[model samples]
Target: MNQNKLQSLMLCLLFYSNVSVYPVTPETIHIIISEDKTMLSEWEIPEELTLDTLESKIGTHDRTNETEDSIKYIWDHLGIVAKFSKNSKFLNKLTVFYATTLKNEEPKQNFKGKMNFFSSDPNQKVEATYKGWICRFKLGNRSLYGICKGENRNLEQIDILSK
Candidate 1:
């Protein structure tokens, strides 16, 4: 092969080898919530997804809701609060606050980050800025929530959900 062709071939092989050595991890979990603010799909956050890692992945501000037992980071843009337990050192809970009520009693087709948990819905520490529909579920708890997109509900992944 020509010198240029050989170099190109070597580069391709190197790229492919590296990719196989280190596979990319899935970052986002696609989910859909019902209009009533219940999770219609199942979502198990990976163990590696801690508060620190989350903040790094999705930038967060200084605003926080903290106590002796737990710490929460609220991302206004993402409309989600990731809660971590003090002793466990992992993301123990997730609460997603909606921006607006379901249109016509149905989940909105798109989440534009326009809505938030109603003032009354949030914990006292965050009530000042948080405000719409709120859905809170614990990770690895007996009660589980499913993932849905505000589109349809077949409940196909039933095994992942809790009774």
Candidate 2:
């Protein structure tokens, strides 16, 4: 694909709420990751989104693609890392990472947190922290805590993975 078209597809993958990842929810987009496919997280894309709009909203950053099939976008200050696979006229196979500190840790955090399951407690809240990411959700009185690392290094040219 051309440069303009590539950028457009990246924007669509990063900020399209109508797009579904797992076909479970129409409004919420969820992604699963990990060696065993045990981690999952929710993401929200902007309603009015475009390449220019994303840059303005998240500020300038770096983009790297060693080949036509894959690309990675990084916004260090904004704590965002996005990876995409290009197969169709429009790119898909999207993965996004937003950097965040876990609880009281200092900023610029990078670590994969552990997943915890707790029994239902009506008066208590669920809590979890992984690496630098934290996920807290409630199902009735049950609580789930999950975390996944979302940072990546840019690949050099001639890399097989990018190829």
Candidate 3:
């Protein structure tokens, strides 16, 4: 082959190799919150947990029932996590950590916090910001805030924009 053609071929190969590839193997992270008698849980790790898993494990209903909204929210967020990991690196890291923690810890009672959405693209960076006694545990500069109040209120909220 001509030298110019050979050089062009090598350049093409180099370009292809340099393209970023996301991690395919699913990594799971779990987070648990409990206060008094109330307990809240979230799983974000494992990029493989699909919409089906979320729907089945947490019920695939809209937030209509005051009694079941919390559970429905959890599954909805899980679906969001699956979608988010497809694009954002920071979100993947956060979900992985969150899921792992929840998977390991035993359920508890009386914990209050909010899960806030964060993003770290090629543009901006953020650190955990807390209000009052609330402690923010950030992952990849992004977060999904949740808060459990006393033994009666167990809230789990997920930020849809994390991805």
TM per candidate: 0.37, 0.29, 0.24
lDDT of 2 by residue, 87-128 (tens): 433222222323354322212332232222333345554343
Clashing pairs in 2: 111-131, 112-131, 113-130, 113-131, 120-141
Error of 1 at 127 (Å): 31
Instruction: lDDT winner between 2 and 3, please give it.
Output: 2
In each prediction, how many residue pairs overlap at the backbone (N, C-alpha, C within less than 3 A)?
Answer: 17, 5, 32
Positional deviation of residue 69's Cα in model 2 after best superposition, in angstroms: 1.8
- The most accurate candidate by lDDT is 1
Please write out the lDDT profile of model 1 over residues 35-110, one tens digit for every residue: 2232212333354466665554445433577788877665544445566677876776665434324322222322
TM-score-based ranking: 1, 2, 3
Writing each residue's lDDT as its tens digit, candidate 3 over 27-53 gives 221234221111113444343444444
lDDT of candidates 1 onward, in order: 0.41, 0.35, 0.32
